[model samples]
Target: MSDAFFSEVTGRIPYAGLDSTDPLAFKVYQPDRLVLGKRMEDHLRVAVCLWHSFNWPGSDVFGVGTFDRPWLDARLDPLVAARAKLDAAFEFLAKLGVPYFCFHDRDVAPEGKTWADTQRTLETVIDQIAGRMEQTGVRLLWGTANLFSHPRYAAGAATNPDPEVVAVAAAQVRSMLDATKRLGGENYVLWGGREGYETLLNTDLAQEETQHARFLAMVAEHKHRIGFKGMLLIEPKPQEPTKHQYDYDVATVRGFLERHDLAGEFRLNLEANHATLAGHSFHHEVAAAIAAGLFGSIDANRGDYQNGWDTDQFPNSVDELALALYEIVRSGGFGSGGFNLDTKLRRQSLDRTDLFHAHIGAIDTLARSLLVAAALIEDGELERLRAERYVGWSGDLGRSILKGDAALELLSVRVLSGDIDPRPVSGRQEMLENVVNRAIWSVDRAELAAIGTPVGAAGRG
Candidate 1:
C-alpha cells in the first residue's frame, strides 16, 4: 500500500497555498482551512472514482490503449492484475488524501466466464478493497452496478423486453447492493445507461415504464431488508448510447419518481457534463434538484463546449461551477453526498504525474468556487434583491389568491373595480451578474487564510 505503483508521488499532497510553484502541491484546497464555520474538507467531501482512474485503459473506440498501466494488461492473470490494480489504487488514494472513493462492480474485478465465477471474483476484490480502506481510512462514497457495458444488457436492464435479462440485472444489482453494505458505503447510485428506447417502432412505452418502476421498488425494498443505511441515488442523462433516457434531467426524474410513488426513496446524482447534455447549465440543474429536494450527490466533470457529447474532462473553470456551488450552499450543503471525480485523463496525458495534476486542479477549482459561494451568501445583496423582487407575494391579495380565498370572478371584479394596473419591471439580470462577478473577483487568498488558519498558511511553501 506504500506507493505500490505510483513511485514518483511521495507522501501525501500538502497545501502549498496559491503561490506555490510545485505542481504536486494543492494550491487552493487546504483541507483544514475553515470555510463557513467548518473545515474545508468537511464542506467538500471529495472522492476519487475507481472506474475512470484505474479501469479505463486510455483507449477510445478508434484507437489502442496508451496508458502505462501494467495492471490493466490482459496477458497477466485477471486476479493477479486485479490485486496489483487495487494496490496502486490504494496508494494513489492515500497519497491524494481523499476521504472517499467510488466504484462500479465491474471496475473492481474482471468478469469471469460464468455468473458464479464473476460473483466470487467480485467478492474477493471487495474483500481486498475493504482491507485497504481500513488501513488508509479512506471510505466508500458509493458503489454501483455497471448495467450497460455487457452484451446481456444491450437492449436494457430492467426495461428489457426479455424477462430473463431483467432477472440478470436484478441479480447483479442485488450482489452490488450487498457489496456496498459490506463496504460501509455512504450511498448507492443507479446509472440507467440504456434504460430508454432507441426507436418507438419496437418500444412499448407503458410496459417499459411499469417494468422500470417495479425494478426500482424491488431495489428499494431490498435495501431496507438488508438494513443498509445509505441514500439511494439515480443519475440523469439526456442520451448517449440511446436516443433518449428516462432520467433526462432533474425535472424529468422528479416527475418519474412522483409517478412511480418512489419520491421518498431516491435522490438525484447530478453531473456537470450530463447537465450540459440535457440542454441546461450545471447551475440550472442544481437549482432544479434543490427546489425539488432531490439533490443528493454530484459527478465532478465538465463537457466540451465545442462538441455536444459528455467529455468527462476534469473541471477547471471556477466561473462554470460557482453558481452551482451557490445553489448547493443555499440548500445547506451536502448531507450524505459528495463531489466524486468522474473524470478521465486526456489520451496524451499518459504520464503518471498527470493523474495527480488532473485531480489537484479540479479540487482547487471546487475549493475556489466554495469561496465565491460563501462570499455571495455573506454579501446579502443577491438574496436581498431576490426577496425584494418577490415581495408582492407577501401581500394580502397574493396570500388570498394562493389560499384559494379569491375566486376568478372576485379577482376580476377587484381588478376591474380597484384601480389595479400592473406593469412589468426590470429583472436587473445584468446587475445581478455583476454582483456575482464581484464576489468571484473580490475573494482573496490572504483574507481566506486569515480566518481560522495559522499565520502564513496561505503563503508559498
Candidate 2:
C-alpha cells in the first residue's frame, strides 16, 4: 500500500500466458478464469502464510539467518519490528492479489516477559493488522499459537509432563483463538509441533495422551463459548522437533478425534510435506481425510524425497499436484479450508523480490495442475475405468456380502458347489499413467495456443 514493500517488483502480477518472459508474472493463475464452473480464485482459495513469508529469518539448524530482512534486524525494538513486518506482509499480500492470509500469535507480535505483556503486544499488533486488512480487503484464513518454538515447550506443549507448562500452553491457545475470532478468521489450526516424546523411557505414554485430549477439549469448549464461526483444524505432522508426533497422519488424527469425541468440532488441515514425511503421498492424505469426511484445509508445500525431514519446499511437480488437486476437487472443494502457501524462500534466494518469484511460480503450478485435473475429471475415462473395475460390487453376491447377508459358511458352500475360481485382471498401471500424461499435454497445448506460441518454440524448462 505505502510504496510497495518490494519496490523493485512493480505492478500487480498479471496472467501473462505461458510464453511470457516476465519472471514476476503468473503464467497460468488467472484469478477470474472459469475452471469447473468456478473461478480459479474461488476454486483454489490461496492464502499467504505470514510466518514463512514475514517471520522466518532463513535460519536453519546448520546456519544462522543469512537473509538481511530489515524488519528482522535485532537492533530494532521488538514491537516496532513487529509493526514493520506486518506492514511489509500486508504489502506483499496486496501486491500478490491473494484474497487471504494467515499468521501465528508470535508471528504478528513479540512475545513479552509476562502473559499479560504478551497478550497486550499481540492485541496491539493485531489492531494494526486489522486496519491494514480492512484497507486492502485481505481476509484472515486462520491464526494459530506458536506452541513449539519457545524453549519452554521443548519437552512438549499439550503433552508436557508438567501441568504448569500445559496450563501455560492452554492460556496461549485461548488468546490465539480469541485473536483468530476477532480477526474473522475462517479456521483455526492446531499443529502438534512438539506434542510427542523423544523416548519411551522419559515419557508416560498414556498420561501424555490424556493431557493432549484434555487440551483439545478445552479449546473446543472455548470455541463454542466464544461463538467463533470458524472450523477447528488439526494439522497432522508425523514428526520434526519431536521423535514421534501424536497426530502422525490423517488416519491417526481421525482416530484421535473419534477417541476423544471431538470429530464434530475438529477437522484436518493436511500438509503436503507432512504427508510425505509420514510415508504417504499428498493425494493419499487428502483422499483419506475426504473419505472420513474430515478434510478441511491444506498447508500447501512440498518436501524433498532425498531427505527424510520436512524441507517445506514450494511445490513444482505438476503430476503430483494434479493428482492431489483431483482428490480435493472430488471432495467438492474446501468448505472452510483454503490453500495456504506454507512455504519459504530458499536460502540462496536472498533478494526481497525473490518472494514474488516464489509465490508466482507456486500459484502458476497449482493453476496448471487444476486445469489438468479438471480435464481428467471432465473426460471421465479414469473415473469410468475405476468404476468398471469395481462393477462386480453391483451384482447380487457382492450386494449380499456388503449388506452382511452372506456368511462365511454360505459363501464357502456356494463356492464349492459352483466350483468357482476367480481370475486376476491386469491393473494397466502404465496405460493409466499415459492417460494422465495425455490430459496434461492437452492442457499444455491449449496454453500454448492462448499465448500464441508454437509448441516447438515454447520450452517447458
Candidate 3:
C-alpha cells in the first residue's frame, strides 16, 4: 500500500447524530457536543493505544498472528517497517479522529545491539512521530516502557534480583520519560508488568520491595530534573506474566505508594480488564481510586465473563462503563489524564476494516455511557441516599469520636446505658439500581437499538 495506508476507509470518520445509520459514522460520540456545560471531547478525552492497535500481530498462545499487517512481517528492515507502521498508524488515527494516542517505547522503535544505538534509533522515530503529530493534530496521551516482553526481564524489571536488569529497566524508563516530555505527552505511565516473583523459593520479598521503591523514587526524581510537567502514573494488574504483581489493584497500589511515600508523586491508570482479573468490578476499582484521590487515567477495555484471565476485549458494556464514569464525573474529572482504549480485536475478526468497526462501536458506547453518568450525577439521588446513609457520622458523637475526644471507656459506658441501641435501616439497594437503570433507559437515543441490561456488580457510586 502507498502512504494512504487505510485506503479502505477513504476519509475521516464523521460524527453523525443518533439517527444516522452510516456504518462508519459515530452515532453518539460527537466530540463537540455539550454534555455537562463542557464539550463532550473535553469531558471524555478518548485516545487509541499504539501497542495493541498496531504493534501486536493478532497472535495468541495457541496460534500465530492472523491479521494482515505487512509492517509486522519479520523479513522487512525494522527501521523501514517502523516508519511504515507509523505512517499507517497516523493515517488511522487521523481518519478515526481521535485526539490522542499512547505507546510504549518499543512499540514504535526496535532496539539496537547497543544501548546507545537503541536510544539513537528511538530518537529518530520520536522526531518523526512528533512531525506527523503536528500535521495530524493528534496528541500523545501517555508513554511507557515495555519492560516485560524481552527475555532479559523474564525474572523481573525493577524487582529483579540481578542489578544489571534493574539498571536496564531504569534506563528504558528514563528514555521513555524524555520521549514523553519531548512529544508533549500528558502523562508517563509505569506498568510493572513483570515486577513480581513467581515463587518465594528464590525471592527476597522485602529486598525486592525495597528495590522497586528505590526505582520508583528515581523515576519521580528524574521527572522533576527533566522538567516533564505530566503526571507520573502507575498501572495496576493483579497477575499475568507473574504469579503476583506488586501493583495488584488500585487499593494495593495506593497502599504501596503511600508506604513508599510516592503517593503524591504518582496517580493510577486503572484498567477494566485488570480489575476483573483482580476479582473486582471495573466500577469498584474506579470508585476506590476516586475515593482515595488516586484516579488519574483509564485503560478502557473489558474482559470476557467466561475467561479467567486478561481478555482485553473492546468495551461494549455501557452499563458497567456508566458506573465508572459516574465516579469520574462526580470527582470533578481527570487532572491531566484521559480514556486510552487499551483494547484489541478478537483474533477471528481479520478484516482490514475491522479496526474501524471495533473503534466506532466502542466510541459510541463511551458516549452513551457518559450521557447516563451525567444524567445520574444531575439526578443527585445516589449521592443524596449515600449521604443519608452516613448521616450519623456527621452527628456530635461522630465528631467527638473522630476528634479523639470520646474515649473507648466512654463509648462503652454509653453502649451500656442502652441509649445507643440502634436498628438497621433499609439500604434500598434495588431502588438505587433502578435509579441507574432509569438514567440509562431514559437517554435520548433517537432510533438506535437498546443497550444490554447491566450484569449486576452492585453499586460502585
What is the TM-score of each predicted model, taking all chains together?
A: 0.97, 0.97, 0.95
Model 1, 5-37: lDDT tens digits are 788898999988666789999988989888889
Runs in model 3 with CA error above 4 Å?
1-3, 445-461
Top model by lDDT, which number?
1
lDDT of 2: 0.90
Candidate 2 wrongly placed segments (more than 4 Å): 449-461
Taken over the whole model, the C-alpha lDDT of each candidate is: 0.92, 0.90, 0.91
Local lDDT at 37 for model 1? 91
Single out the weakest 10-residue window by summed lDDT for candidate 1. Answer: 445-454
Tens-digit lDDT track of model 2 for 1-461: 56546897666777788768999899899999988899999999999998887898899889987775899998999988998998898888888999999999988787898888988999999899889989999999999999998999999999988899999999999999999999999999999899998999999999999999989999999999999999999999999978999999999999988998989989999999999999999999999999999999999999887999988889898889999898889769989889999998889888888999999999898999999999899989989998889999999988999999999999999899985578999888999899999999899787787668787877866
TM-score, candidate 2, is: 0.97
| Candidate 3 residue lDDT tens string, 1-461 | 23366787888899876556788999889898787898888988999999888998999999999887888889998889999899989999989999999999999999899999999999999999999999999999999999999999999999998999999999999999999999999999999989998998999999999999999999999999999999999999999979999999998998999999999999999999999999999999999999898989999999999998888889999999999999999899877999999999999888768999999999999999998999898889999999999999899989999999999999999999996888989999999999999989878642242333242421224
The TM-score of predicted model 3 comes to 0.95
Candidate 3, RMSD to the unseen true structure: 4.9
Error of 2 at 377 (Å): 0.8
